[model samples]
Target chain A: MTDPARAALAITHEPEGGLVLVLRGELDLAGLPGLAPALDDVFALPRQPVVLALDDLTFLDSTGVSLLIRIANHFGTVRTRGAAEPVRRVLEVLGLAGRFGLGEG
Target chain B: MVTSAPRRLSILVGVVLLLITAALSFLAWLAHAESEENLLRRQLAQVGTLLGSQATVLQVQLADIGQVAVATDGNPSAFAAFADRQLTETGQSLSLWRVDGDDMEQVALQGVPPLLPDGGADRLTELEPDGRLVMFGILPGEPRRLAYGLMPGEDNTDFVVYGEAPLAPNGRVEPAEGSPLAGLDLGLYLGEDAAPEQLLQATAPVPIEGRTETTSVPFGNSTLTIVGASQGPLTGIQSAALPWVVLGVGGLLALGGAATFEFVSRRRAEAERLAAENDRLYRQQRGIAGTLQHALLPAVPELPGLEVAARYVAGEDELQVGGDWFDVIGRGPGSCVFVVGDISGRGLPAATTMAALRFAVRAYLAEGHTIEDVLARLRGLLDIETDHQFATVLLGDLDVPAGRLRLVSAGHFPPALLADGEVMLVDCPVGTPVGVSPSVADSAVTVPVTSAATMLAFTDGAVERRGETIDTGLDRLRTAAGGVVSRPLDGMLDDLLGALVSPGNKDDTVLLGVRWG
Candidate 1:
């Protein structure tokens, strides 16, 4: 039960000096609150494209999709990749698939 | 509500039954004790009357013998012959005595002589006129005797006859065998008063605690007191044990009844506890399902120069969450796709399937695929994932700048077009629902779009009811949509749902509407 709510967010430096924020586990209303610090950390880095990797994400909800939209708005160049089927489905349902760059695009 | 009422009534009845049993047992025990006491009193009274009469008869016989001896004028030979004849007839021992001054002289002895103390003979002379008999040597360890005096001559010469007899035939004063008082103790006293010290003959040990009765009998001139005490306030062993038996049996029955009641109550309590626990777990599972359903749906985004409104209503039954979803995807500048679909079944599986399909369509469209291409690709994706599920979907690509709409249907309800105050279902090529077949031959139809046109797409839940046909539901939707086609997109969607969905609808409904401005 706790595993779904303990979704972790990690920031790593890419070889091209871009930042990649990896979101793992469930990203629903329960786990959305923990993403604030990770967002703040990514925004503090030098202005560059930040890759939001959602490949390891097991779940996502409406609230999590809105959170991603806010993160995309904050970064000048935000590209999303590696979203699992469930997470990708939420982004597509909201018509944010093109904006988030999810699913074979 | 009906089931619980009978359970409470049965418990009330059980309590009433237990109370009634206890009351009856107490009443029965009380009646038994009362009857036993009365029986003991009656037996004691009867024994006292019988023993008193026996003592009186013995005293009378002795007094008559004294009169016979006095008639003989103190002659020893004649008195001896007469006393011997009377003693032999009565089966008692007797002696004749002459009273002189204060001494008693033995005139003749027929059998065992009566043991007299020094003043015993003088006391007998004082009883000449009153004819009272004087008893002597009747205490324990003394010979039992009865004496009475008579004055035969006018000159007042005193003659006395004394007899010695066994108080009881075999030194025991019990009632005769087979008598009702056989189980009692009888004490015979030779005086008016029936005191413990005056006890003369006793049948059995006098009980300190029991029912007793005393009767006085006239013996010659003196009264004999017969005191009878019942063995233990009851006639026999059976009678004595009756009250205790009643109480014991009654107590046992009451205990048994109480134990059964307690056992039933405990079982009922255990059943109630288990039912409450089951209800709690059910609610918990429902909560998780609700969370998963809400997480899969997101709000429709606001777009420039277009009115996009969508509504998602869960089933009336809170525990059931299904896979009905609608999406408005932005493809490029002034172009977006509106999708409405219903997945088969319910709960997390349907919800996850709906989510995957919605994303897959958006991904395909983003890569410049038409509605028909997107549906084909979604079917292949589901087939590869081994998801044995199917969905009905309607997809429409709207170009706001060019006012052109491309529509396609995949085993889904046709989208309703409201224009010029008239509502009509769009004519499009329909194919099998996605994921049911390996491939499909379906195409999208391009229709001229106008600013006055409003398009509504919804799942079957919005119009379907039990025992009703799909055509009837479609007609109702068309009529409701015509009334609200001129309103804003949000108001139009609400009015359409209000006319189509009722509180009794058990399936999830999703309505997505777009108005070209």
Candidate 2:
């Protein structure tokens, strides 16, 4: 029953001292409650530059897009890695590709 | 009305629960009564066993007396000594008799004088076999005497010994202190029937009453009937109260269940009513909003050498007054200004913002503001952060005499142009949607219009689908418009909408069309 709202997350510190957060499964309103603590911990990390891995993310909605926007707006040095085409397109249409360092979507 | 249904349901449930409680209570009571009856029978059985043993003891004593009579050759002194230890009460007797056929004569008498009549059959020896112990039956006295006789050895039928025991006056005997039969009302009758005259002793009156247990115990050759009834509950107070307790608790539980059912049903009905009321109100609001939006829009003005047509369709699932509107103003002979705009959200706030933007645009154009300046001025009417809304608009000026057209866009879909029977999307730069950012970089582009060319501009609702690229929707719109552009302007616009608008669209849409010669 909780599987739909279930999110599996992994955080790894890169050799170059950057933190990469991997997101998997659905990312929607229902998953937000369980994800809030993880997000808070990420915001507290000393690392200024953060990389997001969205290759495993199966779904994203407006709320998920809002969270991404908040993350990009927070850390100017943040960049997304392996964002899906649909994910990139949403950011592109909102004209936030430059903010997330995904040029021309 | 809601109360009526819950009340009816509760009544039905209550009746069913009450019936179940009654049935359970009755069964428990029956079982308790059965156990009580069994206990009474057991008590009577115990009394019968004790009395039967007493009868055996009497026979033994009488046989001993008979032996003494034989040893002493019927000496009266020997008989008196044995009889002295055998008599139990003041109104009792013991004697030794010589049985000659059916006539028995007493050899000695001890205690009270024997009640046997002279010259009468001993009755004890008449029916009983030679040496068997037998009942002599009751004798009349202040207190009745119960007599028994035993001849002893079968070889000797001549000598017989008889004994008698007294009963209480009025057939009532006070139970001994601490007697086990203390809790019972008991009656001991001489025979199977508890006849008043045959009752030898009793704790209560002549006959025990109410659910009595009757048991028979052997007394010499006859049987004594012991009839008994419990003075109170045989198994104590808790057992007596158990059935009532079950009934009480069952009744409470049945009531509780019915009340809970009523509460839940009432709550559900209330929720349903509230939901229906909300729906009715929502539809009413939508109707007013639709009417208001139509009133705010201008009637299409006819222009010389030009054809104009437009449509406004509210999405099936869209809020009543979402921001979608179109305007066409006749500027003079062979020229007109057209506008198509869409606001981002829904409801009264979005509708109000849309109205403000529309009137502002009309004022700007009426003041002779250039199409580019007019599109730019629309930005000042709203701020997305404050209103949480933005408008995507397209404006065009068409001149049929010069076959020229000018177009400007504010983050809106590019207008479709059909010229020489070829369909193409206008190459126009889209500015940031108005009210989104403080300042936007934009301009107007003029393109020469071919003779009798038709141009269509519309909102994203005409092509927008969730999770899909807007370009695919645009391509679809372009193809659809191309197929129907050959028809008259009104038919063309209607067909395009029929082809492009899907029922699942949740945003209102507006389409503006202009045909120039």
Candidate closest to the true structure, highest lDDT: 2
- For the second chain of model 1, what is the TM-score against the true structure's chain B? 0.72
| Candidate 2 chain B lDDT trough over 10 residues, lowest sum | B117-126
lDDT per residue for candidate 2 within B1-517, as digits (tens), equals: 8778988898789778988998999998898899999999998898899888988887778778877887887889989998898876687778777777657677888988777633244564653434456776777776677777777664544677777778778778788878866889998888778888888889997567888888998877788998899999998888888889889998998899899888888999899889888889988788777777878877877888778888888878644667788888888888988888877666676677778988888899989999989977888787654665667788888887777788887767678889888888888766656764422356878888887788888886787666666677788998898788789999998998889888777667788888876
Q: How good is model 1 by TM-score?
A: 0.63
Candidate 2 Cα errors over 4 Å, as ranges: A1-105, B1-31, B117-119, B122-130, B247-309, B315-321, B332-335, B436-442, B487-491, B515-517
DockQ of 1: 0.01
lDDT of 2 at B13: 91
Per-residue lDDT for A15 in model 1? 85
Local distance difference test values of all predictions, in order: 0.67, 0.76
Instruction: Report how far off residue B335 is in candidate 1 (Å).
Output: 4.0
Model 1 chain B worst lDDT run, 10 consecutive residues: B145-154
